[model samples]
Target: MSDTNENKLYGLVVEFGDSNALVKAAERVRDSGYTHTDAHAPFPVHGLTEALGIRRTILPWIVLGGGLTGCIGGFMLQYWVSVSAYPLNVGGRPLNSWPSFIPVAFECTILLAGLSAMIGMIALNGLPRPHHPVFNAPNFERASGNGFFLVVEADDPQFDLQSTRALLDDLGGAAVSEVYDD
Candidate 1:
């Protein structure tokens, strides 16, 4: 490919008539050892993630870390205020009482975990992305409504425009189009 054409190249997009075709195409692409591929559908299609060979996300770990930090911080804050900062004696109760810290600790843990999950998901997804290169392809607007789509990025080592288009066509893609860079 010429440098100018290569620069204009974004990827190849394959359109499927339904969820079954989308899943089958994804599986074929995965089995062909194409890693840099994505599938989109109007609704959740069973087994699509596995078909695409998508791995587990680290968002859970992020949330767990956030929760742990919140739990520890909450307990320490209470301890500092009651025992060291103020040292108030309430009804002959000990200043460093452990039971009184449970409620605040629990709330802090939940709050931090939930926030971390939302933020982590958005960050991982590269959200606030008003546009993507795939949107340049014809009929891409149907992806969110009735169409199922599979995209193979140009950066994939196995990608060759002619061969990739042929492969998609062979895999029952009704319409295949070249995606362009934004």
Candidate 2:
């Protein structure tokens, strides 16, 4: 039987004392061609996302699609109801009065777009996560306070335990440790 106490590694975690160090480390890691890397800080660090080669989120496109769908659906619903289901000739207005449908379409656009933004954000982030393997790293609790961390996952094609540890050490990381999977 395998020893469960022998931790299954998730990644390599390198803690930095400050955001500046973390940012520098991230840049170096990116430059070194390590793609599966992430950095964490107690608060947002300007330029750090770019340093990590992060790309723009797709949530806006998702919301736009939802809004367009809502707009079309809203307009069609009104058209069907007024022109097909109940033909009412009021004030000499046309049965398919597109002008009257604008307000409902606008409202539906806002509603669906707002809902899509919320849902897309939640889904994209993989939220409701109560746990993460990085939490197993030493002093990880400080991440919400003062710690800044950079992790290179074990699954990275370039990942090598010794080499990564050495690289993190060279990058001025403190308390470099192995992050374990549960």
Give the per-residue Cα lDDT of candidate 2 at 22.
89
lDDT of 1 by residue, 45-70 (tens): 99999999999999999999999989
**For model 2, how does the per-residue alpha-carbon lDDT over 1-182 read when each residue is reduced to its tens digit?**
12348767788899999998889899999998898999878898998999999999999999999999989999999999999998999999889999989999999999999999999999998997889888878888999999999999999899999998888889987878877886
Question: Model 1 off-target regions past 4 Å?
Answer: 1-7
Candidates' RMSD to native: 2.2, 2.3
Under the 3 Å rule for N, CA and C atoms, how many clashes does model 1 have? 0
Clashing pairs in 2: none
Give the lDDT of residue 14 in candidate 2. 91
Q: C-alpha displacement of 104 in model 1, angstroms?
A: 0.8
Per-residue lDDT, model 1, residue 102, is 99
Q: Please give the TM-score that candidate 2 achieves against the real structure.
A: 0.90
